[model samples]
Target: MRPGQRGARGRRAAVTERNPGREVSAAKALQKVRGQIRLHLLSHRTSVTASGTLHLKEGDVPYTATSRHQGTASVAIKHIPQELVKRKLLMINGDVHDVPVEVVLILKATGGPESAGSSAAMYLLDWYDLDQELILVLERPVPCVDLRQYLKEKGGSLQEHEAKIMMQQLVEAAIELHSKQVFHRDIKLENIIVETGPDVPRARVADFSCGCFARKGHYHLFSGTPKCAPPEWYMHARYKARPTTVWQLGVVLYGMLDGHPSFDTLRFLRNKLPINSELSQNCQELLQMCLSKVPKQRPTLEQLQHHPWLQ
Candidate 1:
């Protein structure tokens, strides 16, 4: 996932104070990186970021360099990696030549905050910080496509079985993240990528730039895409982590099957289009439970996992 996923215009900045010291040159800093340039000036999708492809000479590891100038001091741009190092090497097909391991670059500003919680659910390969830039060396999921692009290839929507499989993996990932007290403020199709294997494709969650460590009764400020914000946030100006996550899950499920969001406004979510005959009965029930107008009425991740639709 990229920093520009979901609503970039409304991204929350790094909660830490800005570093006012003399900035280091990003290009000069990258020169010291232990890698060969495979692709120079790679086209980064977001204008706010610049990225390139790199090949680590040490282990023949392939990685992607995602970087952004601290220009405009964007909150997502301030998302740099913490010092915690966790490594995993997934050997797909039992062949080293196959897909490499998916290493997520979980970032937090240096000396910003303790991020033991946020990095709990993913692997941190390597990270570096310059005075004005934070660069991450992330393992790219090869032979994979983003959920959004995959949906487009499927004529804008997914089949029921395919949707079920993808959503199951995503739900499990969400539950694991929440278990670590890490709130992935943004969860959308764009943030998930599916590996295209010969038999079964797996969905992997990416891009923790908008994520933060949070526990019950701790998260208060708005931190995600406005469209995914729950009714409680709009009506009462505050929202809890669990309920809002459930709402975002509902929105993503709907988008997967319907090719678009279920509703655009709080009024619409509360008063209009409450039913969808296109989906199975259990699936519809799950959506209703997740998209409930009242946060208290929404299902917890535990309850959602036991739902019939997922089973």
Candidate 2:
């Protein structure tokens, strides 16, 4: 039971933009903030942000602080109930190293255009913006069993429909972002969120703080969770960062159905394993096609949508 999971149903709310104006592009609204909490944020084991989030450790309690984050000139202050207040916080660079998803890094990363579309890969939420007292809130991540956990729970077996549904959701989300020209450098089970609520478990892609906007060319990032990453991503981190997202998704889809990785066996010996054969050939082929090392050979999200398994 993660923070977002509600009941045994493993259901999650639809990952929708609840508040429309609630979105504040840290890039666009930079100078709008006011009242920076003047405090020396220090943490012994707590995590922090690069440009905004701060964590502090006091005696035995931990405090989480959101520095006027990105956007706005000067941020505002908001009131927090005594119960909601965490103590002993630490603040650092834009990294915000210690947070639920390390999302602060995306704020530091170059974001795509405001019209980046539904899958733009990231969004700026306006949670706390009053008198420096930040009201930090985050999106309700999708609540579905991660591949590894799913395998363990299912003993390495998943229905074809289940695997296809998950892959379709991820591919569609990627399509949305691609249409808007935003490149999500990282895509893995740890990052892919699924809404488990009775609402068809809409899968939402997340973690774009490390994404690319204008594509000055991949900068080789040690992004992507280890198991789901493409071989090229591991070898050439910076320059080949985002292009491999599709491949990662493929690997994730394969692992979901087969209970193991789809990459090279020797290289990924530590990662590779066997999987269940409870899926249709069409679906497996689709997964393998996406995992192709040749980026161009990977089916576009649009192409994937029309996949026979999906059809």
lDDT of each: 0.54, 0.46
TM-score of each: 0.61, 0.53
Per-residue CA lDDT of model 1 for 129-192, tens digit only, reads 3332344544444466777898888898887788888778778877766654556766777777
Q: Positional deviation of 122 in candidate 1, in angstroms?
A: 5.6
Superposed on all Cα atoms, model 2 deviates from the true structure by an RMSD in Å of: 14.2
Error of 1 at 162 (Å): 1.1
- Runs of candidate 2 with Cα error greater than 4 angstroms are 1-124, 127-136, 141-157, 214-216, 234-243, 261-278
Listed per model in order, the count of residue pairs whose N, CA or C atoms clash below 3 Å is: 4, 61
Candidate 1 ranges beyond 4 A from true positions: 1-122, 261-267, 270-275
Candidate with the greatest lDDT versus the true structure: 1
RMSD in order of candidates: 15.5, 14.2
Best by TM-score: 1
Please report, as a residue range, the 10-residue window in candidate 2 with the lowest summed lDDT. 34-43
